[model samples]
Target: MSYAVTARAALFTLATALTLSPPAQAAVSADCTESSITLPPGALYPNGIARAADGTLYVGLITSGNVLRKRPGKAWETFFPGADTVFASNALRLDERRGLLWGNSPDFLSGGKARANRIYALNVADGTLNRSLALPAGEMGNDIVLGADGTVYVTETRGGGILRLRPGETAFSTLYRDPQLAAPSGLGAAGIVLLDDRLMAVANFGTGKLYTLSYNDPKPQLTEMQLPRLIENPDGMGLAPDGALIVLENGILSGQGRILRIPSPKAAGMHQLEVLREGMESPVNLTITPQGCAFVSESRIRHRLLPGHETEVPDSFRLYQLPLPLTAAQ
Candidate 1:
């Protein structure tokens, strides 16, 4: 089943029966001795996460569309306050070379009630809003990845296409669109990355398939990436220095997320999947540091609300760090 369909069923089956309680104050871990960065429970609904070169952590909250950051050995602080216009922040991409951090706000939290569904960029140094461009009608901005030439490529989960913004351009133009790209319920595309100047890859959350598009093609054409097996509910994606792909499986209603490391699509068809971690609680997005360590956000969304009931979430949300030297299936 597609996320869009599952979401509708959940809202219909649970919205009326569940009476949400006041969110608990965020709980931070007393110990930083571990690899993971613990979130305050009150920072509920974290989806988009990114890291700066200096190790500062940035996270976007879906509940309030607020952005938060934490420096090394410091506590999490609100970087961008709640906004009525921005509904939910999904995937965040940090452009270290340009000193900008881009955020995807598809209005998922508002159920599309937000006045503007757009992609916004912030000054990484001070968290000031730099640019906000509204997406075309029927599109929900989901993931963003920067090209080598500074072009921004974004996925439209519902709109069933990709939009592009060239360097120094204020407005985004449609790069590609195909109804077949949309999920069964019409909202499908998720994670995306430009492997290099020529190849681009995307994950279909609705069908659990990875696809590739060539920039050199006169017309954008997408072909299913050959994987050893299906990756159920793939969301966030990242590229390793060695050219391997890191994929996050934001597990279906179960919240049992996992991560995968795979070679480039050009390497081979149906290559074996290397599982980096498993049994996570609704892991959303991830980013890697130059030193090779990766950070992942655990949203635990299902714990807060089931199809027929609502329960209190943990006192704090959590971001776990997986040390380098991640092993793959031999």
Candidate 2:
């Protein structure tokens, strides 16, 4: 089925029974260990994360559309506030060379406002809007990744395609689209990571499948990766320095979220996935630092999506940092 059909079903579901009430406010859990950074009270649902070279972290909230930032030894502060244009922020990518942070602002929960989905670029030094590029009508922007040559790539969850915006280009063009990228029910492409200028890894949220796209030539080749077993709800992903694939399985309704590490994802044949962490609330996205540490954002969206769980939304959110099991040769 096409994304349009699935999106209509999702919107209808959200409109009727899944409309959630305001979450109850509370304090951060005392069990939040030192490895985790607690978000401010009522941070809502955080979905995306980006880390800078200086250890500054940026997190994007899905429901509130606010972006929070934290320095190496400071508290989390609001970097960008929700606005009429940016109603929902999804995935985030940092373009360090350009000194910009790129994010998706989809109108997923805007109640059929027909607003164009946006790919926003913000100044990394300060949370100032650098540009807001509108996507095609009916396209839902989901994930973002920057190429080595300053090209920006985004996934269209509702359009079931990859969109590209080259440097100095004002409008985006469709890079690749296939039926495998679309879901019959829920979201389609949810996470994306560029392995290099020629290749990218994409995860399907609805199908829980992984695919690698090679854009070296005019015709991009999409290949389904063979995995050892079935995965669930792959949301955000990153490429480890050691060539491993780090992914988050955000259990939107089932509450079975986890983080997985797949060694040598580019290798041929079946790849074995190792569970690095499990029993997370609703992990959404992650950003890997050069020092082999990964910070994961737990959106906890199940509280809003599941019936009778509205009050279960935590008062504060969190970003947990985990050390990647890299080789000792470094």
Predicted structure with the largest lDDT when compared to the true one: 2
Q: Tell me the tens digit of each residue's lDDT in model 1 across 133-194.
A: 88876667778888767689998887677889999898888888766557764557788878
- Clashing residue pairs, candidate 2? none
| Top candidate by TM-score | 2
Model 2 is weakest, by summed lDDT over 10 consecutive residues, at 12-21
Candidate 2 regions exceeding 4 Å error are 1-34, 111-114, 328-330
The deviation in Å at residue 242 for candidate 1 is 1.5
Work out candidate 1's RMSD over C-alphas. 8.2
Error of 2 at 33 (Å): 10
Residue 75, candidate 1: Cα error in Å is 1.7
- Please write out the lDDT profile of model 2 over residues 1-330, one tens digit for every residue: 011222223221111222112211212224222388888887877887898988888888786568888887898888888676776667878889989988888764434755778888888877888888898877887888888877998888865789999989999999998889887764788788987777899988777789999966689999999875546667789987777788887655456788888777788897767777878977878888775678898877666655476567677778897777664333
Question: What's the lDDT for all of these models?
Answer: 0.70, 0.75
128: Cα error in model 1, Å: 1.5
What C-alpha RMSD separates each model from the true structure? 8.2, 8.0
